[model samples]
Target: MAGVISGHPLDTLRIRLQQPSSSSSFSALKVLRSMASSEGPLALYKGMSAPLASVAFQNAVVFQVYAVLSRAFDSRNGRDPPSYKSVVLGGVGTGALQSLILCPVELIKIQLQLQKQASRGLGPMGLIRRIMEREGVKGMYRGLAVTALRDAPAHGVYFWTYEYTREHLHPGCRQCEENTTTTLTLGKMLVAGGVAGVASWVCCYPLDVLKSRLQGEPAAYTGILHCFRKSVREEGPAVLWRGLGTAVARAFVVNGAIFSAYEVALRCLSSYQGGQSPSPAAE
Candidate 1:
């Protein structure tokens, strides 16, 4: 939730920057200042509720699916470090499965974020009600294919990179998994997480651009392919890469905090199992 809150404003900016109306001259600072002047600072957090609600479920879905898939190969036990191939496969599966849930959540968020009038502060429930009344059920999952395309390979690369980077940072993590006294190197873990986050976004940002366009302006194009062709023809290939810098930057910060929090929670729970109760509330 903290990660979502902290990164959502930048996310809103990135989405706007990806829109067809934006261009090389549509600077992040300029857009931000425009939003602030037009809609107040809170406009930056316009679509937060849907994604905020999704954080726990999304992470749980990702990690849970990863755990199951990781354990599926070789003679590996629960404590063994998964092979990189297994990591990628697990992440891909996780991403595909999670997209079914995430698609609707993001559809609502995108609509809320792009709304011209933020003065009234439309809530998620209200926005959801409106979409249902007007566009029906299919509207909520408008960009599922594009979402899957963005997430599947991105998540695969993400899990692999995090595992690879963490192993490089602390080669002993695999050996120490079962040790109750073993402590993760906080600095190394955070670095690995940040790098992993950046890797995921860098690998699949163009698909994300399409997903945003498809959802935000569903009537503008037939589908992802149409959206892609139209975006490139009109804006050039470079348009797909727009807002990438903001995305990678946001990914690094938000995912660094998320992974660190996960590790802390895992440690706290492990300690509790050994008859110690440490508060994980700080996380």
Candidate 2:
């Protein structure tokens, strides 16, 4: 949710920048300033509510699925608890599967944000209804391929790095050796998640750029291959990395906060459900 809210404005600016006319007419900074001036700063947040709701629902579902799948595997393997690799794999699988739910919300949000400067009369609901009316349900999923392509790896890396750090960095964390009452620490997860976020962003940024362009600038691309070729040819290779800094910054801040909060939430919930008092880790 933090990621969705904090990043929307920048996301808007990014879409505008990809428009061919926007490239020659305005720099990214100018576009941001222009939007603020013309539409008010809140205009940059046009579709924020959907993304916030999406994030909350998606995270809840994905994490629950991951935990359940991991536990099932652990029981089947008789390993007492799963390995970090199993956890990471579970997370990857969850992320990929969740793309089905995620894509539509993302599509709606992107369309809404970009609609601020729309060359058409259709606003958010109108555009969505039109897509449903014209292209049926599938239109909402127009760029699912690239979304899955980018997110599977990005989310895989995120979970992989987080689990890997927890496995290796703190001796016996996997065994809960500090104490049964002691859950994973927020500070620790924040540090780990921050690192993981940076790694994920770097590894998957180009794909993200591709995904964004594919969704926000359909005329600019025919498919993923064509998107890459055209982005390079028209915007120069570097433009493919246009909002990388903002993305990385967003990942560092948002993921760090979310992962930390999640760990704390999970610990608290576990404590409450177990009929045990909250531990220091829940602090």
Candidate 3:
């Protein structure tokens, strides 16, 4: 929730910038200015409710799924240091499972965010009702396959990067996996999480562009490959990389905050489990 709240403005910008309609006139600066000026600053967070409502639960699912899959894939079950391969595989499973719940939430978010005027004043439930009215339940899952494709390998790379970076950052430590008792320097944790986010976003932004298009403009394109070819043919290859800057920037901040919070939460949970409490600074 903290990460999502902090990053949503940039996310809104990134989504707008990724759309097919974002022409030469719609640079990041211009989009930001236009939205703020016309719709008020709050427009920057137009679609945040959907994600905000679900992010804690979503992240819970992500970490839980990743932990389970990691142990399943690793012979040592994280008794020994975990392998990068197992980490990636675990991430893949986590992301695939995440997509099942995420697809509809994101579909609603895209619709709500893409609305031109806040004067329309459509909340998440209203948007969902509109979607159901127009296309029914199947419409809610518009970008499931694309979201899975984008997320699976991206999340694989994501967890692998985090694990690799976090491990090397404190090579002397045994490193914490499920053990919430172990802690690393907060700064290093932030770096690992931020870099992991950047790696994931950069690795699969093209698929994300395709997803936004599919979900945002359902009638515009048929399927993933068709959408890709059409976007490339019409907008050139650079289209796929549109909003890459905004996303990368947002990813760094958002994931950094997320991991930091995650660590803090773990310590809190551990403390409640009759383990050592975090220091004042950590608290």
Candidate 4:
């Protein structure tokens, strides 16, 4: 929630920037300032409800699916610690599953975010109902394929980078010392998650730009490939990375919070269930 709120302004700007437009001189900061001046400061958080409401479920599905798949793969290979392949597979599975849920959530969110830009005068629910009335259930899932395309590799890199960073940062875990503490410190958690977040976005940002365009307005592009080709052809190659700066910035803070909070919660729950105090290494 904190991450979303913190990065929403940039996200809003990114969405507007990604919208198919003949005008190629769109600047992030200029767009942001224009939004603030024309619409109130609160305009930045126009579609926040969709994400805030769905984030918990979305994250739960992604992490749970990833964890289950990863564990299963590890057990199958008789590997105590899963290989990078297993981790990537798990991440892909997570992305695939999460994309199913994310499609509608993102549709609603993007529609709301781009409501002003698209000049759609409807609230979130109204927009949802309108889409349903006009395009049926499938309408809500405007860009599921591209979403999955972006997410699969993005999450693969996400988990891979996170695991790599965690393992390297706390080499003690590799030794498997009986008396060694395996607690994740706040600093380590932030660093690993932040790096993972940046790596994931940097790896898949172009796909994300395409996904956003597809989801934002279907009329702009015929299909995913069409959108890709048109984006490159019309806007030049730089258009593919329109909002990358804000995206990477947002990913760092959001993923950092996600991992840190998840780790803290897991440790707290384990300690409570086991009737034991928190580990000394978990500061």
Return the TM-score for each candidate structure: 0.93, 0.86, 0.92, 0.93
User: What does candidate 2's lDDT look like per residue over 20-84, in tens digits?
Assistant: 44354456788788888877788788767667777888888877887776665554555456766
Q: Clashing pairs in model 3? A: none
Which ranking of candidates, highest lDDT first? 3, 1, 4, 2
Off by over 4 Å in 1: 74-79, 118-122, 276-283
Tens digits of lDDT, candidate 4, 189-257:
888899999999999888888888888878878998899998899889999888788887888888988
Range of the 10 consecutive residues with the lowest summed lDDT in candidate 2: 17-26
Model 1, 113-228: lDDT tens per residue? 89886357468898788889998998888999989988899989988898888878777775676454545567766888899999999999999999999988888999888999
lDDT winner between candidates 3 and 4: 3
- Reference-based TM-score, model 4: 0.93
Identify the leading candidate in terms of lDDT. Answer: 3
Where is model 1 poorest over a 10-residue stretch in terms of lDDT? Answer: 274-283
> On residues 232-268, what C-alpha lDDT tens digit does candidate 3 reach at each position?
9988899989999999999999998887788767766
